[model samples]
Target: MAEGICCEFLKGLQKIKIAEELISLGKIACDIIIISLISQFKSIISMLFLGHLGDIELAGGSLSAGVANITGYSIVKGLAMGMEPICSQAYGAQELTVFRKIYKKTLRLVLVACFLISLLWLNIEPVFLLLGQNQAIISVAKVYITYSIPELIAQAYLNPLRIFMRTQNITKPLTISVTCAMIFHFPISYILAVYFNLGVRGVALASACNTVITILGSLTHLYLSRTAVRPWDRQAIDMRLEDWKPLLSLMVPSVFSVCLEWWWYEIMILLCGQLSDPQASVSAMGILMQTTALLYVFPFSLNQGLSTLVGQALGAEQPARAQRTAIMGIGVATVCGLLCFAFTIVVKNVWGKLYTGELEVLALTSAALPIVGICELGNSPQTASCGILTGSARPRIGACINFVSFYLVGLPVAVFMAFRLDMGFLGFWYGLAAAQASCACMMICIVVWTDWNHQAERARGLTQTTEEQASLLS
Candidate 1:
């Protein structure tokens, strides 16, 4: 009877542990989702104000934004991600000095990159002219991008700071900062765009202003919060050549992984313009892409949350807990995917109405929405597994897997089915579904087969200082 009671108690304890983890994951994910939504809403507000100026303003602004995303923002975001594993692990291991060093190093690297990107932005007109763009549109794009350089500089600070705070599970400050910025974004944008009559240039400057506000707010909170306090080590601040090697090693592959995936979507949009009915096909594709992005928010949030939890667990030398977190994260991703699938199906007939009134676009969207739903079943798990890989400091592996799945397998299938076999636009989505399925399967296998104990050892090696390791050994 005593033994039976002990077993029951152990089972109950396990149940409680699982519940606690779920709650923690949910809280982190929710905060991240809120931040993402607010950011997206800010973009919408900018677009709306630009649209009010005229279609030319809207088209030019939109074109500039796309170019900025492809060239500047994506690369900066990926580079910032390189610090995730190090920061998460350092915080987990309670190596506050290491964490601070990584943050400073990443911020410097990103700022340098922003400088190069600004040069490119300044000379973008010749490139756009070479691509056969309209002279008027290119002229407007030049103005918009030129004024947007400050925003890139702001991102250099914001991106690294966000990753640093996130790894430490300090998200509330970020949320509050973004919220305050958003509240001011509209009025500031209006004053500049309309009150000052600066057109798109004013709008771009307003965006820069918004980011500055967010940065100031976040920094203010960090300064006041005792939990986030980390005094900079004078020696660590003076980084040597070797100090940058580890970060670059992780940063390069991460850039490739993120850029490869992002470029694929842009390529798809370009391909749609080549279709027989270019207007309708491109319109439908745009609607579908927007739908996909909206569905992605939750899975992406889960990805970030899981990355932190797994890195923290491994850093703390709890291999078993890290493994458990990986499993539970995948399970949660599956449920989220199912819900996304259901949402697409239920809204299929009516969803396109939100974006457009054309019957042809609506019909195409209705048919393709289910395919997108199917894709989510795989995308959710793939995204979650990426987080696990990131936490384990094995992003190179994920990059390789993404290249094979998206470019090698998915792209050819899309071209062949869409053109060779006459599948049209639907064929494009079918190809995406295939890629997501293959990517998910491969990533899930990798996560399940990971040796958590080995990863913990790696975390120790990564997070500990030379002195700390040597002392521990002695």
Candidate 2:
């Protein structure tokens, strides 16, 4: 009788342990997901304002935004991600100074990157013209891109700060900051764009103002919270140009991997601009992009959390734990993908109405929803797998896979379908789906066969080198 009781107690304890792990993961994941949603909402609000202006403005804004994402934001964001492996592992390894140094270095690098991207934005007009976009869209796009400059600079800083907080498991502050920023966005946008009559440029200024608020909020929270993360050491802010070499080594592949996938989507948008009815096609593509970006917050948050989790586990020298984190992340992402697929399908007919009311835009957007929704099913898992790779310090593999899947295979099929077969926007989306499917399959295989123990060793080596270099410089 006593033995039976002891066995039952052990079983209960095991269940509790499992439950605790899941809860911990869920809590962090959910907070980051909320933050991501709020960030996406900022874009949606801007689009809503633009959509209301006119179809031409909507198309122009969408194209310029797409171009900006590919040329500027994506590169900055990807380079900042180089900090993920560094900071997460440093936190796990209890190397606080190392984390601070890397953070400072990353900040400097991204600032320089912002300056370079600004140059690109300055000369964006000719690029649009050469690409054969409508002259009216080109003109409006130039103004929109011009006003969006501040927002671009703000993001260059915001992304690195967000990653810094995430590595320390300090997410609630980020969530709160972003929420406050988003809440402030709507009224500010209405006042500037409508009441003040600044038009599209007003909308852009409002967005920049909101981002500044978000930055201030996040900085204030971080400075005030004594228990959340470690304090900054003033000494670590030295101009450590040497540190960037190793970081950039990881960053180059990381940038390419992220840019390839992002640029592919932008290519789709550009292709839509080339369709017979440019206005309707571009408007539909814009709506679909906004919708997917909203739904994408889930998997993307999963990616961020999983990267931190796996990086920490590996840094702590627990290969098995890292492997398990990867598996659990995949499970969560798959479920999110399935749920998104179902919801998008149910809302397909009415989804367009949320963005626009034009008969042509509504019809085209509704038709594209199914394809976009189905793409989400594959995209979620693929995105999770990419997160795993980021954590494992193997971004080069991801870069190679993305290039091959998206460019070598998917691009050709998309072009053939959209242009040759006359499938138009539907065919463009189908090509995206195919790319997602292929990337997911390859990434899944890579994750399954990954040697987590080896990755841990690699992480240790990377951190050890950073520590050594820091000591030498000091």
Candidate 3:
């Protein structure tokens, strides 16, 4: 009896150890998932609310989102991408002076960009009209555009602060910030749109309000960074043209290339709305898209975690370790992708049914499910590869690869297969299979050709090469 008890105790201890490991992993997966989910949740809210306004409004919202989301997300996330590598490397080397300087400049950049965005909002109606959208849509979209504009500034500041914490793996606060924002934004948006009958303009205002609230909270969280802050230099001034060149060089290509990807998505929505069943297509796809986007949190989070670890590791001159970390992240993402795959394949129709009872919409989404799942499988590896490259500060290559894979190759082929053949919504989604598949193939190629073994060495050389090009500024 004592022997049995002893054996049971040992088994319990083993289980505890296993549980700890899983918990550690869960934290990473959770952080990224939260980041992606919270960021995209506003869109989900807008979609759900707008979905109720009949198919025309639903179609308009999706088109607006596709155009608006691509514009907003690509620009904001593009700039935000700059924050991760810069902070990771700076923090890795314990360079607080540089970090502060970078922060200041980045903040200035963000503020300036936001002002420009505000002006754009003022003139967005004519711009939409010029783009050949319906007159009514052009009118409605202006309000949403105005609301989205103010949020950009908030996101600019918020991105740096959130990413700064992310480098330190302090994601709980960011998560809370997003949660609180949603809390404030959702009911408020609902009240404005439904109760007050403010319509789409209310959505714009609610989103802007949400951004301000979240940004303030995120800024407050940064106080902790000062406490955890290592002993470092002061005089938060740097004429370090060298420091920024690397960041900008890496960022530009990525920004330009993704423009195409964004265009394809935005344009697809535009085209989808012109379809025979615009309302059904938009409502059904909108729900499914949000579901897929939410599920995307895990893989996207894995990508962020891998980038953080790998970038820091590369900064610390441990390229082999970084490579292994990337592999592990991919492995984890692949597993999660499989789960999402099953969810979409086996239970997507179930999800569609739960979200709405419309037989027509359900039928469309059901037809699209198989293609969507397949897209995830291809997208997971490619998505994770984005982090792998960003860690190396070699974003241009990834960007170019994605551009070719998605636009030059993916978009044209997809459109032909879908529209030319009248494959309908299913055809449209099937095209992504080609795009994502090509992207996956290209990203894999880029990763393999890049020297994971000497990533740290490459980083050091990048610093040197950057210095050689110009004098450091003050």
lDDT of 2 by residue, 7-53 (tens): 99989986675576567678778998888877778888999999988
Clashing pairs in 1: none
Mark the regions of model 1 whose C-alpha exceeds 4 Å error after superposition.
Answer: 230-238, 465-474
Candidate 3 stretches with Cα past 4 Å from truth are: 1-26, 46-66, 131-134, 187-202, 224-226, 230-243, 273-279, 355-358, 461-474
Deviation of model 1 at 332, angstroms: 0.2
Model 1, C-alpha of 291: deviation from truth (Å) = 1.3
Candidate 2: stretches off by over 4 Å: 1-17, 51-60, 133-139, 194-198, 236-242, 273-280, 353-367, 419-422, 467-474
Q: lDDT of all the models against the reference? A: 0.90, 0.84, 0.70
Q: Report the C-alpha displacement of residue 43, candidate 2, in angstroms.
A: 1.9
Model 1: weakest 10-residue lDDT segment is 465-474
* lDDT value for model 1: 0.90
On a 0 to 1 TM-score scale, where does candidate 2 land against the true structure? 0.89
What order do you get sorting by lDDT, best first? Answer: 1, 2, 3
Clashes of 2: 0
Query: Which pairs of residues clash in candidate 2, taking residues 3 or more apart in a chain or in different chains?
Result: none
Clashing pairs in 3: 32-301, 239-473, 239-474
- Top lDDT model: 1
Better of 2 and 3 by TM-score: 2
TM-score of each: 0.96, 0.89, 0.83
